[model samples]
Target: MALTIMIADDHPAVLYGLRRLLENAPRSRFVIADAVEGGQALLRSLRGRDCDLALVDWYMPPERGPSGRELLARLRTTFPQTTLVVMTASQQPAVLAASLAAGATGLYDKRECSSQLPRILYQAAQGRLCVSPSLEIVLERHYLTRYHWGQENHQALTPREREVMRLIAAGYTGRETAAQLKRSEKTISRQRRSALDKLGLNPDSVPTLAPG
Candidate 1:
């Protein structure tokens, strides 16, 4: 039987690229069933269609779209038969760790191409786990170090505060951070100020210490 595959990503360019790649493959080997966002992907799958595997994006913008650990957890319960693979541009240790825990059978970076994807998909189709080559080191370190999820709470920053920290850490200017987070520049400024204050650093200072 040809392996049926589904891909979920927010970017039209990526969706097109993935479709093109898959189409170039030996048609006798694969079939594209559905392509949609995280939520819609789940809904489509639940409609009783059969799929061998699903490639899910690690992050989809806007709330209620599956991303992070929640998406993995949902797939585990909702589609136990379909193998789940997470694809992401991010190399963040936290993001990778959380995705695996959420029940991903395979994890691949978006940077990987069709040449590599086929083998991974073939492995997944055979009930084997497929972890990305690039992330193996990071995942290994995470396991050896005994990293814990939800430990961000130790810093005691609310979700909004964590957003601010990530933007700043990524070196987004205050204005850019505001636009990205959909808040007023003034509000973002205040949140950064408060975060810096709580961390006992000058608000004007660059980050130097780990989150408390």
Candidate 2:
């Protein structure tokens, strides 16, 4: 039997192109689903659709506005057996590293969609890691930087603190952040203050925290 595959992307053009690519492949059976955002894709996959691979958009609007990392972490935990492949245009080292750390089996640069995808998908299906060469270079540099930065620097923030920082960076007001984090407004305020103080990130500084 051929492997089952699912593609989750927000852009209509990318979705159409991906469909054409998969449909033309000669070796595997693929199941494709279109979702405007990440949550819906997770919902459909969790319904026991039995996909062997999932090609997820690197960024998507969250269902309830949760961070993309949180959503990806949830999906990874819930669907441990499915091979998750990130298909995104983001070539930033930090972005690629985060996706791989979030349990993606492979990271395919969207620019490589024309010819590289089929081989990457096939490799991922066989339990091998796949990542764009550009991303690999970034990952290597990131690894070296971390080695120099020491584990202590990396351990500075708790997961919750990071989440709070991310939400704030996303432009969520205190009240909105409180609701999203499921905490009292006062608690959210405190968390934000603490994160800002630690990161030396000025509360007034504007940061575009891109999803995931």
Candidate 3:
């Protein structure tokens, strides 16, 4: 059976090109279910017919609808059965991470569409996760960074900074921490500021009542 795919892009020309690309694949079995207007329209269209896959653009307009990461999340939550492949040019790590979390089966970069889109769709049809090389590395780095933060905590902190944070986290006063580490109180104060910088904490957000 041919897989049913819907192209949900705002531009008609782009949709036409994508439809042609998939329809004309030499040894492929795919049929165009419909070309939706955008992200919101696709969600509405799903109420009537089921599609095997959807090629979605990241952005959509009109005040009532969601776009980008929000749209990806809604599609996954509302239509879990469809394999969604985000067709976009966005390379931001946060966007990539959010799309994956929202259950995107693949991410096809429009900048590299001509060369990579075919392989992307082919793999999606075969039920595998496919992504553009650049997006893949962005996602890999995103995951590794998060993993290090979650698992090792303070991976971004220097050894001295980590010691400072650890002592502070353990409820030690600046003076007591300095004593414990055999460092001067002034040195402890500077170490705290350095740790805050590495830990991405703002000094303004620090508790005024916190250890001296």
| Candidate number with greatest TM-score | 3
Q: Which candidate model has the greater TM-score, 1 or 3?
A: 3
Candidate 3 wrong stretches, greater than 4 Å: 145-212
| Residue 25, candidate 3: alpha-carbon lDDT | 79
lDDT of 3 by residue, 62-87 (tens): 55367777887787778778888887
Residue-level lDDT of model 2, residues 89-135, one tens digit each, is: 88665577677667777888887546778778888888888777766
Report, for every candidate in turn, its global Cα lDDT versus the true structure.
0.70, 0.67, 0.74
lDDT, model 1, position 182: 93
Candidate 3: the clashing residue pairs are: none
Q: Candidates' TM-scores? A: 0.63, 0.63, 0.65
Per-residue lDDT of 157 in model 3 = 73
Q: Show the lowest summed lDDT stretch of 10 residues, model 1.
A: 145-154
Clashing pairs in 2: none
Clash totals for all candidate models: 0, 0, 0
- The most accurate candidate by lDDT is 3
Sum up the clashes in candidate 3. 0
Candidate 1 TM-score versus the reference: 0.63
Q: Whose lDDT is higher: candidate 1's or candidate 2's?
A: 1
**lDDT ranking of the models:** 3, 1, 2
